[model samples]
Target: MPAHIGRPVINLGAHRVDTDALIEHIRTTYSDPDEHPRMGVWERIIRNAGVTQRYWTRPLAEATATTGVARRAETAFGDALDLAETAARRALDDAGLDPGDIDGIITSHTTSWTVPNLDVHLVERLGLRPTVARMPLTTLACAGGAHALVRALYFAQARPGARILVVVAETLSTIYHQAETTPQSMIYRALFGDSAGAVIVTGVTDENADGLGPGLLADDPFELVLPGSRDRYWGTIDDDGLHFESTRAAARAAADSLPYLTDWIGNRAVEWVVAHPGGPRIIDDVVAGVGLDPEKHGRHSHASLAENGNLGGAAVLDVLRRMHDDPPVSGDPGVLAAFGPGFNLAAIYGCWA
Candidate 1:
């Protein structure tokens, strides 16, 4: 092994739309008085979220439209390839490594499908080594990104001197409900957007290793099981679009658990919190649960909320990218957390180096 364990994320790149354009797009496309009221509820919620921009895989119509099976299939397949390739290459470039140097690939996307999956497609398009190992995660929702990263770390631990490329491309926009108005459905619609991110991790490190930084803080992974919360947020294909349900109780459970986890990790206030930017209410509830100044975490939370809405598995990374780009200081500590299908929360603490 060269030097370090889990390499620190050194650079991040993303593409997104500003808040004003996103709000206008949502109002013009999805919300209607009959189906959705002009009470300015969503607008007010988003504005309070503190996000100024977000990104997606397609226009809002494509998300909730009733299209022929053949057309939907075609769109999903093609878009999956485009998203995977774009994100993978960007991460490779940021790490200053040629794609061929990626000894392994871990791809994560929950909202769509591809025949060979993005790993094989990326191997072919980017001309990676023919023997590059492939690991693809299609489920697990928002937790997929961190899961993939941790898996990469595990692989490195198994065999020293290996390099793994981890990529997450969850297109939440591809799964949408335009006409649903229940609290669950409304929360789902209000939260999700589409985006992708990738990171390069080397098993071995060096003082001069490109795109590599400090070691990862250690922590055991835990999943909080909230019984009967299975249906709190579930997605299914329908004529109107992909339908989602986000229950009030589920949101409360996620909020309630934050404090316990925070305290377990050794303190109440962290230098940074990378909580998933699910929606205004979810963030608000989590803020109250953690009892920290929302103003501190509010900017990244609201910024990710406003800009990308919620990018499912990619949401936490979107926030992390913001922190990586404009970090607070060299020794600041952070907690990266997100809630997912198990109605569970996942967290890892880190130091900025």
Candidate 2:
């Protein structure tokens, strides 16, 4: 049975910050003349990051304040769990299903260091039955959203009549550490936002489903890892908090590994695409690598980045939500893909229903 993805719901942070203002604030924080040299470069990078505004779980002053890992984890987890619950409720309501209807739950959360993950917390908070199956992805990073949905598809296919709830929440603002001055860290300061997104997946196509809202009929889920590409993207933790690190190869990793995606999409006229808003480079590569028009097919992905910054695992979900504004014709073939720290790629092909 083909899995159908219902409309996704997204929740962003309370604190919204414009890119320009954020750049200026960052400069003021690092007042030393020597720091100015590096801050100067980051300012240019921020200007070109293709982001207008982003949300943070905490206030700018508090978020940018250096802190211990234990405190960061306590706050980040509280924020993520709160955000995920809201998104999950909205998603269930959108699907016209009660919490009891979901038989399986899949969640991806890497921004916070939490012992009991989102899946367990959601089941308890949402009043789901204890027997409900759970799958939590803690290390997928930015790719976690699409990664969770791909797993949801598998669950729906494996169990007939199963309805899976997919949720991803990130408090990316917690990674803003004043101590880290690397270029990659600087770009990250401009590149990420805090968000949570959720959607319901059921094992039924348009032909079989009765009251499902406008969404995609999912199929052909795929995942890949470039051999010896571990260095492309990785994360580390320290006294200040989490840090996102990347190398030059990370810039080209998407383009390098997209051939496998294009291969699987062979001979199919993929009419639309929802690529991860990792940054401008990843979006551009998805356009060229997949042979799609940036103006038409890639516009929503760009819009997500411009408006929300990169919402980590929530990016693909946010992009999918935006597609409804300029929806494709029913049955139009499309692809959704996300890349994260492993230089890992998770993709799912579908058609508007």
Candidate 3:
């Protein structure tokens, strides 16, 4: 039996920051007398980041304040919980199921560190059964959303009637630092937003599962961790908070992983390509690498990035939501892919129902 993915719901932070404004803010906060020579270069890079606007839980002023890690973590934890709960409720509603019906829950997040992880918090707030199975995932970074779904699919398959809730939330804005002058850190401020996304997955035999949504075929779900590519994209924690390490190689990693993805996809007719919009460059690279017709399928990924910035693991789900809103013809096969730290590539094959 296959696992079906119900409608996905997304919740973004309250404040939307324009890219130009963000660039100016970065210039004021991160610019140094010694780095004056490179300020022009930094401006060019920020303008080309492919984000026109991004949403945040707090305004730029609040985020850039001289706050300690404890304060930032507190803000992140609260914001994450609010967004995660909201997205989860919306997803459950779309699936036409109740919280009590959820037999298992899987959560993926990386923007903050906390005890009692999100799954535990959600189970309590959502009124799910205490006995419900729970899995909380971290460290997958931007790939966490798709990876969570992949894991949920497996759970659904094992427990025939299980209805699983998969939630991914990231409050990346909380990690922004004025002290970190690295180019990657500066770009991160302009490229990422706070957002949460949730979806419900159920086995074919699950109650009220008469094909309510797209089916995740049990045949092929693929994951690849590129050898020695860890440095392409990663994060480090210190007294200042989480600092991101990103190289130009991060954008090209998707193209590099394409051969492996193609091999995993085999001869399947992939009519729609739902890819994580890592950035404009990454999106273009993946389209070219996968042989996709830009006019036909490229907009799906671009729209997400242009509108939502990078929501980390929540990004793939945002793209999925867009695809669902304007669906393809029934029986059309599709591929979903996302890349994150570990230079990992996670993908799943599905068909429109």
Candidate 4:
């Protein structure tokens, strides 16, 4: 009795900003005496990020405005809701189902802080039944999307014939702060983008459910959290907005987790790999860590990163969507992997039906 995950539907922000333009904008915005000297360094980092373009919920100019955090949070709140609704609706439609069919909802968001969470609002916006079970995750960050699916698998297994909707949305652009002159902030501002993605997971009694979706096998998923690695990547709330704290060691930490990853994967043949596009180095680490053939399985994750930049938890779903659109040979086994703030690595093995 495996749960099936529907094809994911992704919705990127309205504006697509060229990477070169973004670098130039960053230079102009931080042209103060104290920050002027580091413009060239920032430029180098931006180019090395391996992203040519990324979408933003609002125009770059508006996003980089000197507005206070209150205003930024306010704007992000509204935009997140709109994107969440769009992706969720599209995902439901893609599964050949309606809102009423969804028995549970799972949402993952890290870009903004809100009391009621996106799940509550999404249920209303999409006209779902009020009694639908809801679980909203705010802590997973980049790993949230894959983790959402893992959680959905658990829910589906617990209640047979359950239909679950998973939505992951991030407005990283809203967290860009011109006041922060640190290299971590600069890299985050240049590399991150805004996007939303949704998927439907249906629990079925039969393992060979016809065209139900990609089956998340009954096998247990894998997770690894490095001890005391919390400070390697995180965000802090200040008057301006959320400030990112990322260290060079973060990439090394990702690579270091390879042994644990290998142990969890065991002897499974991973024909396809869905990895979170943390950055060039992180992707490289994952490829090496998971022992994947770069020529064969690496393109999907790299393509997702190049096109959408890093959408945080929404990234893995984007990659999964691409695989669904083109699809691999039926019954090909695949693996989904992502890393987030807890210095956590989460992976799930599945097969296309």
Candidate 5:
């Protein structure tokens, strides 16, 4: 059985943060020359990230303030679970299905460190059956949504008549620690938001798998990790909180994986692309690497960045949601791609159905 993914529902954070306002606040707060000697580079990176606005699950001040690991973890997990529940309920309604219709649950979250992950909490809150299969992915970051969908495809094939619900939620705004002064850290501070997204994958007959509907059915899924590139992005512990860092080489990591991706794409005529809105460069790299028409495709990606910054694990689903809003021609061939901490790449080859 082939699996057809349904349209997703998104729930955004309540606290809106404007890029211009954020820029002003950072300038004033980190004004000491001795502390931030290279403030100019940091400012440029933030400005060039192309994020006009984003939202924080908590107040902007608290999200950026120096806080202990335990406090940050508690707050981030609380907000993430709330948003996830809302998105899951909306997704069930969108698919015209009940909570019992879901035979399996897949959740991807990485914003906080905690035991008894979001999957079990969601299962309890949504009133799902205790026997429903569950898969929890905790560290994929921006690639979480794409990876979950990849897993759902196989789950559908295995169970034949199964229906799987995939959920992704992230409180990335919690990463904004004022203790970090690197240019990369500044770019990250400007490039993330808090959000949750959920969608359903239903097992369908072969005839219904390759045609036009509201979404792309899963036909093929691919992943790649570049050699010796593990350090492109990583995390560390500090007195303030968990800190995510990106190397200067990280800017080129997405494009660097293109050769392997293109080899997989082969002769497939790609009519569209759903790129993760990690930043301006990531989107541009997709457009360039895949030979997509810059004037037309990947608009959803750029739009997501401008409207909501980066929603971490929820970023790709938001991109897919925009694709659903203004749909493509029936049966259009496209690829979904995202990058994460391991310098890992995940892509799905599918067509509009």
Candidate 6:
């Protein structure tokens, strides 16, 4: 097989809004301990998401030249772009590569949308090569980080020595609606957090210079199908903001999808499992579905949830960052996975360089 030719993870940069202050504000704002027991439940639920903090653009008031919480929805599109650019630049610096070296750029976000989109603005502001290819993925949910990585890997494989940037920005804070108590809305309130994680991957022949090993994708890999369950999750643009739908069936869907996932990991000694920390219940179902030890990734996943809440598309990247900064018990060959809309699950193989 030909060498895949690029380092999987040369470096990573993560930025977040002030977490402690945000937590305090949330606790203060939702001060009715009696009226909102769920609020208290969430204060505890957030601790398990494997995030310590997140970076966000200004609140809706600041993002928009307006007053009141309802007006904040209007500014979400703009703030997402602001956060993405800031994180992407930091990632380029982390990789010690100039923006001009970037031959491809992939941006992942689920919270907001813009007319020209983030890619166009980033290209101009970062001084990227004029010919740089851009891929913007939206509405993919938590699996987006892994999805972006897969896209970058393919680009590097086709163009040997090419550099690609993957930027994941999400602002769940901007989408929160206090009036709605739908299951989906409650899930968002319980899980979502604001954050961005960026990484630069470059095709490199030398193994030592690469901080991580290249991901060797096996040709003709088996596809594990979840049968595309719409019963799990859905989202749409509404007059006020995008409204999402999540069913109790989602947990059942995750549970039912496990055997197929386990078949994919058959016989592989997964040294580390990097999964998006959706929540304790959702993650537990994922672990059970994949037939893996819940204890293996429990600590990291819990830490992310506890500290960061849920960062939507950025959650898995946050997990990767924690692993990169404080690796899980050192070794080789870690299995990374994430779930997204369309009720999709993506897995990848990575090793320490």
Comparing 1 and 2 on TM-score, the stronger one = 2
All candidates in order of TM-score, best leading = 2, 5, 4, 3, 1, 6
The Cα local distance difference test for each model comes to 0.63, 0.89, 0.84, 0.83, 0.88, 0.62
Q: What overall lDDT, based on C-alpha atoms, would model 2 receive against the true structure?
A: 0.89
Q: What TM-score do all the candidates reach, one by one?
A: 0.80, 0.97, 0.95, 0.95, 0.96, 0.79
lDDT (C-alpha) at residue 257 in model 4: 74
Best by TM-score: 2
Clashes of 4: 0
Structure candidate 5, residue pairs in collision = 213-353
**Model 6 CA lDDT for position 24:** 64
Runs off by more than 4 Å, candidate 3: 30-37, 206-211, 214-219
* lDDT string, candidate 4, 207-299, tens digits: 436657553443357788878888688778877876668787776777777788888888987777787888888887787667777656768
- Tens digits of lDDT, candidate 2, 1-353: 67888778999999998987898898898889878878778888887888999999898999888679989988998999999999999999887889999999999999878778888899999999899999999999899999998999999888866899999999999988887778888789898999999998888844558766678888779999877889999999887778888898888899988888999889888888989998888898897678888777788888999999999999999999988767899989889999998889999998998
Question: Could you tell me which residue pairs clash in candidate 4?
Answer: none
Report the number of clashing residue pairs per model. 10, 0, 0, 0, 1, 22
Candidate 4 local lDDT, residue 136: 97
Give per-residue CA lDDT, model 3, range 193-221, as digits (tens).
89999998877774645656564444357
Of 1 and 6, which scores higher on lDDT?
A: 1
Q: lDDT of model 2 at residue 23?
A: 85
Quality of model 5 by C-alpha lDDT: 0.88
Ten-residue segment with the worst summed lDDT in candidate 6? Answer: 1-10
Which number leads on lDDT? Answer: 2
Candidate 6 residue lDDT tens string, 1-353: 11132222212123344445544655665568564666655555444444456444565224223234345544665566666777777776656778887889988777765556667777888889889999988767677877877776667667766677888777676555555544456456546666676777665445534453433322112223378687687776665666567787776655666676667778766566666687777666665555567776555666777667767777777767666666645345556667776787766665544
Candidate 5 regions with alpha-carbon error over 4 angstroms: 33-39, 206-212
